[model samples]
Target: MTSSIRRIPRRMPGWAKVLTAFVLVLVVLFAGVRLAVLPGLRDLFGTETQDRSGPALLKSIQDMSRYDAASGNFQVVVDLEKDAKYLPDVLHGSRTLYVGAGTVDAYVDLGRLGGNDVTVDADRTSATLRLPHARLGKPALDPDRSYAVSKQRGLLDRLGDLFSDNPNSEQAVQKLAVRHIGEAAKDSGLTARAETNTTDMLQGLLSSLGFKEVHITYRS
Candidate 1:
């Protein structure tokens, strides 16, 4: 008598191979979304910043120009919020935050002048001046005066913030507040007053220098 045995096929079928590859691709995509993309998405809809302390935190930024003719000081309270949702229609998945008590400084620059800006009348009795338009300088936020108004974060957002290295959200709000203040100051005739003050000072100086008639004008 003779005995026989059957062997099972070891090679995978084409359909099964394709299905396996597809699953692997899905897993890789999911991982990428979970790790890399999610955090960015949070901030694309979010903001954050490093926490600085002490004198470093009280950073002062101003023009080095020695003469400041007129100054407009403003006090602003900013309340802001943001929300991020992987899906926007069905539900509100993002959180919002608030920042408050912001301030800004606007001043006129008299130290900046062209060489031929000042003209003297022929008799050495009168003088005229040409001045450039007034402009705003960079904003400097006073940390001590500012505060975090409030914040409400979703679970996903809180999770997202843990890993994000973006700039401080409060700083963004502070900047916006200061910007608005600067705009308002400009519109409220801050520059005009500055120009007037400058003219008065120059007139007084010219009088002391023995000039009788003074003519002043702005280039802008």
Candidate 2:
């Protein structure tokens, strides 16, 4: 029995196994940083390096003061039903329940500012800018978060589903949901916050660039 027993194979050194695992971990980490993490970080902190106008360099680059401060993700379950006006409901019937998520962004646009909207003091010590009214961007539906929660279709509708083309009530529900998200953004006071944030950011930036006084105003 002892002679028949299989000989044991030599084990690898503990240090060699540890080194292999460490290399694998490093490769994974590097791959993740390169593929996913770095690109997003770059966009969040990206800045333009346009020339600083004038010898004194008191230029007001009223370049779009984009404030992506107010962000909202809204989830809504919308029910859509086809109506039978003056006819039997069973003839056309339907209902689709959708669970959708929408993303909205509100920004303060200084893009309306022209050369006259910016005022730079003679000694480059003071500056003032007139900013345009803040506005909300279009609501975008996130396909990942947006989908049909549950749909109950009438027999005729289910039969029609197999056929060629027909108007989708779900699309109408989605459009309404998107419009609601946009209205919600306006009611959420995003514009006020964007204005305040833009003002503070421009003040600090100008103050740092040798301007002792910075004035920022918004117009409707």
Candidate that would win on lDDT = 2
- Clash counts per candidate, in order, are 5, 0
For candidate 1, which ten residues in a row score worst on lDDT? 89-98
Candidate 2 — what's its lDDT?
0.76
Candidate 2 C-alpha lDDT tens digits along 132-201: 8777789998878788867665545644664747634467778877877777777788778877877888
Top TM-score: which candidate number?
2
Instruction: Give the TM-score of each candidate.
Output: 0.57, 0.63
Root-mean-square deviation per candidate: 10.9, 21.6
Provide the overall lDDT of each model, using Cα atoms, as 2-decimal numbers: 0.64, 0.76
The count of backbone overlaps in candidate 1 is: 5
lDDT of 1 by residue, 1-220 (tens): 9988889879999999999986876686467567656766655655577877656465688657633566665666665655554645223343334333433344455676777988876789978778776555555556676676565545445445546896235566667777777666667676677677777887899899999988888776
State in Å the error of residue 51, model 2: 45
lDDT of 1 at 219: 77
